[model samples]
Target: MTAPASSRLGIYCMLGGMFLISINDMLIKSLSGGYSLHQLVLMRSLVGVFFTLFMLKMEGGFAVLRTGRPGLHLLRALLIVFANTSLYAAIVSMPLATATALYFASPLFVTLLSIPVLGERVGPRRFAAVGIGFAGVLTMMAPQLAGKGDIGWVMILPVMAAAGYACMAVLTRKLGATSRASALAIHLQVAFVIVSLGVWAVAGDGRFAEGTDNESVRFLLRAWVWPETGDLAAIAGLGVMSAVVGYLMTQAYRLSRASTVAPFEYVLLLYSLFWGWSIFGEWPEPTVFIGAAVIIAAGVYVFMREDRVKATRRT
Candidate 1:
């Protein structure tokens, strides 16, 4: 395909993937009241694993899963498990847009980590952008800091989730040279299975006996209840959504320049906002809108700057 055509396809794939992901978050958040995080993860991972296996078979049978970098893939999976768990925790308590906006800091974290991890040098401009981006984070977090909001300490979960996601991104870049995207994707499902089962074994029974009123704690500690038919269908759909999201996002980056497609990811915030409002009657505060704008602007600037640097080096 022509570069322009390929880039357009990539952008569309990204938008589709982000939209599905936003929906997945909404579903997870909606189900948080009735399901333990471990139960949700375990159920979703089972479906994801089956879906991924089917995908792998269609792609090239089992050989496509072969990789020499199992250790790296394992670490990446662990990081993602952490990221997903924390994100779900945040989602249970915080408005979707607010949680998503805080998680938007992943790109900034990636930029900062690149210097030390990849030995990339950042110029002053991108450094300034990072500073401004962090300022935006603090702006969204101001209410929590002042002890005036409902979010409280749970707000930090998304930031921690973002950091974990950033680390996974860096590691994925390092492994991209040799690993199949399918392998990487399935490894995450495997990790989710392992982690979820571990959590269920250790805490599920005890927590079920004594449930707390706090949503976040209940989300974490609640035992597996048999989901209602609708909830079951939704949770099952989550697996399918995750598979589609993985395919689209992977194809998106594969089909175009990362810098070209990265900016479009900010659309996730808008999708989150819409879902938050429509489903939960929750809207972000004005301060959140301002903070999100700053974060998105900074992230886009970083991507643009990186593109410029690459262009300059090529010249």
Candidate 2:
């Protein structure tokens, strides 16, 4: 495919992936009250594994799953697992819009990591953008930082999640040259299964259990109960949504330059805002809007700089 066409496809795919992910988060948050996080993840991963295997069979065969870079795939999977756990924990208590806005920092994290990890030269323009982006983060976090609001330390979880996701995004680009998108998706789902099961086993013993008043702790340590029929169906739907999300996002980074497609991820904040209001009747505060606008501006500036750099090289 031509570079222009490939980049367009990558952006569209990313939008679709983000939409599905937003819906998945909405459903997960709705069900978080009745189910443990581990149970939710485990059930979803179990269904995702089957969906992946079926997709593999229909596409070609199991042969596509074979990979020479097992170590890299393992590392990517581990990073995604950490990202999932942290973000899920955060959203259980925080509004979806707030969590999504905080998670948008992932692109900035990617730009910063690319300098050292990929040996890419970041000029003054991009450096300033990164600094501004971080300042936006601090702005959104100011209430908690000043100990004025109830958000407290749980506000940091989404930032941790974004960092893990940034690392995984870089690794996805590195592995894209050699790995099939199916292989990457399957590896991540498998990792989710393993990690969720381990947590379920350990936390079931009462070691992690504390009090139910705290949403984050409740999500982590709550015992699993049998899900209602409606919730079970919703959980199954989440599996399908996640499978689609994983495949499309992997293809997004694999098909074009990450910088070219990264900005479209801001669409997620829009989707999250809709779901937050429609489903949960939650809305972001005025400060969050100001902070999100600053972060989005900084992220767009960084991408524009990268595009200029690429254009100069081509010329």
Candidate 3:
């Protein structure tokens, strides 16, 4: 009885987390035109650390910060940084909707990677789904291949980002179970600090000096023109949303198994499409939608098949 109840709670958390993550994607797109991706990443990471820490304190105080699995935390953090950086780069370079559609390919990558890394069995039906998902990616990307003023190659950024995210997922499932969420969150920030600082140093060029010689650097460093008061509110809103989404997402995984939670991530692409159309006035091409549909269907089939297989094994 307790097991069933806990499982139900976990599923709820996972859905909540996905919803928050979708919202975060929307906020990032909302601010894209005004802010450089670099500045946005830095701001979000810096602000996010505060909220994560606060949640950690609430959960278990200082003890939550302790982790026996430093190496696993380090790997997860690095993977997260890579994913964030790549996704941000994609956001800056391509249409949000398109990039997100491509990013959805991450699950497919995860499916494939699991065979090699986790030794998970992939049946024929699941293999077909993986193939179809990649086909959808190709279908969506075909137009860009013609080089008709479409810099769609930038879509690959999100795909790579997704792969990094998938790696994080893999690590989380394999090693993070024993680690407290607070400890994991803290290590994530420490990793972010390292990555962000490294990016700032290599990309910085003394823009911090703020003088005539550094005017160009400042412009690059500054995400956008002095945002209006409303924009400021929006940026801060994104910060708050990040915290909320991250917390909910963390909670969701705590309640559920990774395989169970993984499939719902597909729903995020739908949200991305809705936001992209509403906010950016950009409707994806017909093929993009078709491709997305194929990918999503494939993912669903894979999930169902895997569950069936697991059930059979148990029986």
Candidate 4:
């Protein structure tokens, strides 16, 4: 494919994945009050694995899952596992807006890592655009950021998640040359299954969650129970979303430079705004619009700038 076309496709995949993940997160948060984290992970991973097999069939076949770079796959899986777990833990522990805002820092990490890891040239303007976009994210999240003064060290979880996720994306680009997108995704699912089962074996009885009034800790260590039919349906939705999102995210980073695709993630904030108002009835304040505008401008600048640079090289 031509560079411009490939870049656009990658952006579309990133936007689509982010849009679905926003909805999936809302559903998971709704379920977190009753279910343990490990149980949720185990259930979702099983369902996700099933769905991913279908994707595997459609996208070449099961043979595509084989990889010579097992070590990189193992590291990538560990990073993504840390990223998702830490982000989810932070979501249950703090305000969703706060956790999300903190996690958006991943784009900045991606831009920075693209330089040293991928050897991509991130120009000064592109770097500034990323910073401006992040500033916009903070602006949109200002209201939620205020009350978190007492959140203490719990706030670091999302940042850690961001770093882990950024590293994973960089690795995705590195592995994309040798592995299919489904391979990148299913390996992570297998890792999730193993980790969740290990946790269940050690503490699924709720002994650790017993006396914890802390929401995040209790959610993490809570004992598994027989899920209600409604909750099962909701988690099943998460699994489906997870499988599609996994492929979309992998394809996105695989096809474009991390720096090129990362800025488009700002659109996720807009998705959150729309979903928040429509589903949850939370009307966004003016700062949110202001921030959204800034984010959009920055993302557009990055897109045009990258396309121009690629064109110049081609010419």
lDDT of 4 by residue, 92-158 (tens): 6655555665676675677788889899898999899888977876775556557734455566787
Off by over 4 Å in 4: 1-16, 130-148, 247-264, 274-304
Error of 4 at 283 (Å): 7.4
Worst 10 residues of 2 by lDDT: 204-213
What local lDDT score does residue 293 receive in model 2, on the 0 to 100 scale? 90
Q: Candidate 1 residues 1-315, lDDT tens each?
A: 456999999999999999999999999998887889889889988999999998777767778778887778888999999999899988988899999999999999999999987888899999999999999999999887789887788888999999999999999888877777777788889899999989888887745538467787888888777778878889899988888999999999989898989999999999999999999999887898899999999999999999899889999
Ranking by lDDT: 1, 2, 4, 3
What are the Cα lDDT values of the candidates? 0.90, 0.87, 0.71, 0.80
Error of 3 at 95 (Å): 2.9
Of the candidates numbered 2 and 3, which has the greater TM-score value?
2
Each candidate structure's TM-score, on Cα atoms with residue i matched to residue i, is: 0.95, 0.91, 0.82, 0.80
- Find the 10 residues in a row with the least total lDDT in model 1: 205-214
Give the CA lDDT, 0 to 100, for residue 143 in model 4.
61
Alpha-carbon runs more than 4 Å astray in model 1: 1-3, 58-61, 64-66, 206-211
lDDT of 2 by residue, 1-315 (tens): 456888889999999999999999999899988888889999999999998887777656778877888888898899998898899999988889999888888889999989877888899889999899989888999987689878789889999999999999889878877766677778888898998888877785445666458898888788877789878889999998888887798789778786778788899999999999999999887778888998999998988888889889899
- Give one digit per residue, the lDDT tens place, for model 3 in 267-301: 77777777777877767677778888887787777
